[model samples]
Structures are given as structure tokens and as C-alpha cells.
Target: MLDFPNWQNWIEKPSSIIKKLRQKLDQMVGVEIKLAEARSGPPTGMALNLEIRGEDFNQMSEAVEEIKQKIKNIPGLVDLTDDFDRSRPELKVIIDRDKASRLGLRARDIANTVRTAFNGKKVSVFRDGTEEYDIWVQLDQSFRSNQSDLSSLFIYTPSGEPVRLSEIARVDSGPSYGSIRHVDTVRTITISADAFRMPGPVLVMKTKQVLNKLDLPQGVTYQFTGEDENRKESQIFIGQALIIAILLILVVMVAQFNSIALPLIVISSVLMSVMGVIIGLIVHDRPFGIIMTGVGTVALAGIVVNNAIVMLDYVIKLRKKGYQRNEAMILAAAVRFRPVVLTAVTTVLGLVPIAIGMDIDFSRESIILFGAASASFWKSMALAIMYGLGVTTLLTLFLLPALYSLVEGGKERLRGLFSSKEIVY
Candidate 1:
């Protein structure tokens, strides 16, 4: 762990290498090597936070250990730690108020006496030249090592009579931490780990599955925080933004086409493009909420409608020139075929590099520049738009024409039904 390189030149991922090292460390009982991810931005880790409202520390500790074992069995979760240290033993001095009062000794006197003996209160600063050091006065270490020794220490009452500490107070030894932590005004113990090879959302999904089967006791509750919380919130916001973007696109389409029916046909192409986007993601096994993919979806919305408008506008012009509905649609598609295919090809070609990642290897060429973690950040966006536009181009040519005919045919049937003369029986 000492003198580690800032950048690695190995072919295997750093995380995988760290995992191997961690497994070696795990073989020896009570020896742990926490491979904290050396990265920028918010740290990449998952936390299963539990809030125990009850004051029973032993019960809470048991629950925490149980949860630790549960998460430990989960796949793709590594470096599991509950962060509860039990080795540190503490001695608590409980003063007997009635005994202390009868002995004419104040509780403060006993506390100050114990603190001064154990902690050695600084009485002065010893200075030599420009160097200075604190001068603390306290009894030898032997006097504070055991309860019997501590109890033998003397504290004076107001009447100047010395009283043994055992007469007024008792010392109890147990396991405890130096400090307690509170989050949002509630005591919380967070069990956290590094998520290796699995995306944040996937890790959260698997962890929740393990949590669901366990029947938690009353007053004991858990929450998902860290990357998982941020991922969920971002997904919600992105979904809302996509909806608003679609609605805005629809309004613009309505204004352009001047016919609500025609715009509906154009919007159908957007849905058609989703199939290609999904196929691309499935083929590559990329998660959807990586920021880039959501952005691509929104960008796809605008790109998709442009092609539909091109085809639909020509169809409308043909209809206005007195051509039959079906014939006009067919001719419009035939005429726009080259332009649509060309545009889609150019766009897809533009994104191919980012989708597949840059050909340059940062390992040997410039290890420090790229560090690790591969260059696939924008891959999702590129693949989404590339595949979506390809499918959209074809759908715009064929399916759009058929859908237009069907919608127009439906309108005609509706008019005939409403305007026909009623037959009298």
C-alpha cells in the first residue's frame, strides 16, 4: 500500500487487481485491506444506512452484524464494512449521589480528580528558545491502569477530609466508541462497500432484493443513500424533462403541420425509434441512466421529428395538388428516400467513434492522462442516437406512410358515420 503508482500500465482493470489483493488479505482472520477507489468527483461507493432509534446498543450492534452478513453474500458487492469497532474498551465512572452527599463530597470534585489523574490536565507551557511544550501533571500510569487503583485515588471533601473514590463512585468497564455519529438529528450507522463491475443502479437493485427478505424489527429502518439515491433522483428528473420535451415537440409539430392528425403520425415515428435504441443498449449491456443516454434520448426526440416532417410535408403538398391519399404518401416516401438515408448515415457515422470509444490506448501512450476506468462515458449517447436514427429513417419511409393512410381512412369513416342520413323504420 506504500508508494503506490498514481497511474497503472496494466491491461487488467485496477478494481480487479485490487479485488485479488483484497481476497488475499481476507484469508487471514481480522486482517482487512480497504481498497478505497482513488477517483475524482463524488466517491464511488454504496451505503446501506440503518437508523436505530432505540437506546439499546447491544441490540443495534446485533442488527448491524446481521445486515453485514446479508450484504456480504451479495454478488458484485466488495469491501463490505459495518465500521463498528468492538475492540476498544472503556471505563465509565458512575458516581453515587447519595453516598457522595453524605460524604460531603461534590460530584464535580470526583470528576475533576479522576480527569486530572487519567488525562493529566496541562498546568503550564514549558518554553525553550522558540520551541514550546505542554507541561501536564498527573499520577503515574500504574495508578490509572485498573479500577482498584483508580478507586484508591483520594478526593477531598469541603471539610478537608480525604475520601477514597471507592466510597463515593464505582467504575464499570465495557466496549464503547470515543464518539457517536448523528445524521439529520438521528443516530445512524452506515454499512457501505465498493461496487465492482456492477453499475450503481444494478448494485442498489441486488442489495434491495437481499434486504426485502429480512423482516426488520420495529424502530429499525434502512435507507439507500450515496450513488443509488442520486441515480434514482436523476432518473425521475430526466423522465420529467423528456416528457416536457416531447410535449413541446408535439406543440411545434401541430403548429407546423396545421393538422392535429398529421402531427400524431410524425410522433409515432419517435416511438418507433425507441426499439432500435433499446436493441443497441441490450446488445452492449449498457445501463440507461448514465446521464449521457438520457441526453441522447432527448436529442433523438428532436432528430426523429425532423425526418418525419420532411416526409409528411411532401405528402401534404401532393395531396393539395389533387393526388389520391395513398398514391401521394407512396410517392412522397419514394422521393425522400435518398435524403433521409443520407442524413441518418451521416449522423450515425459522426457518433460511431464516441460509441465505440477512441482507438487510442491510454495505458502505454499516456497512462497519467487517462489514468484508468476506460473512455466510454459518451458511448451510451452515441449508441442511442446512432441506432435510433437508423431505425427512425427506415420507419419514416415505410411505416409512416401506412400509418398516415390508416389515420386518414379512419377520419373519412368517422365523417361518413356522422353525416349520413338516418334510415326511418
Candidate 2:
């Protein structure tokens, strides 16, 4: 319930320190503490927001407790808690309608008397030189501490007789009323937690697995919100963007090459580049489907095609200049090898440091490159770009020449079969 100012020495393991403090604090009476750190992701400090809705508060409280337990079992999910507090003691006054009616007392009179007694009635405002304070009148704290004292309160009846509250009302002690949350007109309870040492997608997958096993009561359902919702939405848009980019690239290539086959040959190399992307992510222990990784894959699409386009253009020029198909292909591959290798190597080398987490520092004030947290943010992108470009370059030099030869040879064979004059019967 308290936030400590940054007055203590820095510790490397804050969670461990908090655990130690919890152990000591548990033994003390009337004091309890639970430490929670802010959730990590985007600008919203929420990794998981599970909203449970039901008509009954008791069922909802039980469901919240169950979910909190399951969340604790999940690895790297920390600081789990719900907003409801159902254990606090409260005193409820149940008015007897028949007894109140016989005494000529209305329910409103009893309610108003109880409210005025507990909440205090403000009578007058005392003005000071610069400040005004309200004077309130209420029973002494000692006389209002227990349910027996509340039952002993007296209120005036309509016949001008004073009757004890116990004559027409009863006081019962039980669980206090907690806050009720509403979403779209239905009551809801949210259980939230922070993910530690894991990404948002992975945590969401794990949470889904846990939730799938539960058999929720009728009229009770759950939904995900906060960062998880945003992540899902962003993934859909990213997929659409990638598809549009591919279509745009294909259209441009079709115009430049004037042939569907050549454009396909160029676009197919993007798949080859994706092989290297998968390998890089696996080898570097990074998760797939990250925003930066998708960005790198899109960038690789444009980059990998450049080399193939250059080599193909030269082959076309040579063929038009009266060179044989086989001769032009051999020459194109040989002459373009240096340019292709040089371009790929320069680009890969530039990004290799970033892939390996050697951060690029543009600021002259700091020479530190590696071991910073921010450096790893771009690690997935760099690895995808570096490996994708390298692998696709090699595939372009070798596989592209073979594909072109096969397509052209098949066309030549079909032309000879259709145009031949010789016939035997």
C-alpha cells in the first residue's frame, strides 16, 4: 500500500531482496506487504489482463482466486493479483419490516439514522484566517467499534418514542462489499500480472493453455485485453502488410521483365530467404513473429531480388546480342559472381555486429557497445536481414541459373515439336 522513495542502494536482484523482506514481514502482526513491479511492453504496463464476468460475486471471486493460482504456476509470470478483497470484515444491519411497521418507523428513517451515526453529520463551517474547516458530530470511536454498539443505537419513532435499533433491526458481521467493475453493462473482475524474462507472445500462449483447461460456469466467460489484445491486432495488420508488399513487388517485376516466369523466379527467392530467417531465429534463441523480424523479412524481399534482377538482365542482353542460351547463362553467372558476393558480404558484415548484439552507438559520449539492454531490441531484425540476404544470394547465383535454363529449354523443345514439317505414316 506504500511506495518507497528511491533512497536505498541499488541491488542487482530486486526480486530476491523483496522475497527476503516478505519472509521477515510475514512474522509481524497487523502488517503485510506484497511487492509488484510495473509490467513491461510498449507504453502500457500490462502483460496479461484477464476479465472474468458473472452475475454472482461469489463465483467471480472464486474464479479470480483460481486464475491467480494458475498464473503463479506459469514460469516467468510474476506479481499476480486481483483487485477484489473479499476477506475484510463488515457489519450489516437487516431491518425488520413488520417490527418497523408496528413501531410506525420506515426503513428510510433507520437507514438515515445509521448513515448519520457512522458517517458523521456536518453542522457548521468554522472560518479561520485563510482556511475553513467543517465541524462534524458523531458518536465516540470506542462506542461505535462493534456490532453490539451499532445495535444499541436509538432512533426516534413517528409517535415521538425512542426505540433501540435492536428492537426493529439486526446487525450481522460478514464479508465486506468490494468494488464492482462493469464492462459493456456486465459486472467484471480483472486479474493482471507482469511477465518476467519472457516476451508477450510466449506469455500469452502459456496463459491460453492454462485457461483452456478450466470449465467455466454458465453465464461466466473471460476475455483478454491490454497488451495481449494489441499484439493480436498488430499481427493481423502485419500479415496484411506483408501480403501487399509481395503483390507490389511482383507487379513491378512483371513490368520490368515483361514475362511472368522471370517475375516468379525472382519472387520465389523470397521463400529461400525465409529459410535463413528461420535458421537465424532458431540459432540465436529469439522468438519468431516479432514485429522487427517481420520488418526484416520485408526488407530482405527487396534486397534479395536486386542481385537476381541484375544477373537476369545481363543474360537477356547477351542472348539478344546473338549469344547461345547456354553460353549466356555461363557468362552471366561467372561475370556477376563478384558483384553478388561483394554486395552480400558488405551488407552482412555491417549487420553482423548488430545480430550478435554488438550495438551501434552514434553518440560520441559513450564507447560502450555490447551488454546493454537496448542493443538486443534490434537483434532479431539484424539476424533476419543478415542471414536472409546471405543465404538468398547464394541460392540466386546457383538455383536461378538452373531454373532459367529449364524454362527456356522447355520452351525451345515445345517450339520445335509444334513447328516441325517432317511426318511419318
Q: Residues 1-425, candidate 2, lDDT per residue (tens digit)? A: 43433212344445466666656775777544455543222466467888899899888888888878877889877656677766777788899999999988999999988888888889899999999999998888998888888999998998889999999988998877666678999988888877766776788789999989987777888998888887778778777887888899889989988889888888888899999999888887888755778888888888988898998999999999999998999999999999999999999999877665564445546454654444566778888998899889989889998889988899899999988967779
Best by lDDT: 2
Model 2 Cα RMSD, Å?
5.2
List the candidates' TM-scores in order. 0.83, 0.77
Candidate 2, pairs of clashing residues: none
Model 1 quality (TM-score)? 0.83
Identify the runs in model 2 with alpha carbons over 4 angstroms from their true place: 1-41, 44-49, 63-78, 99-109, 120-143, 154-163, 191-200, 210-214, 359-366, 410-425
Off by over 4 Å in 1: 1-16, 36-43, 47-55, 120-149, 359-373, 422-425
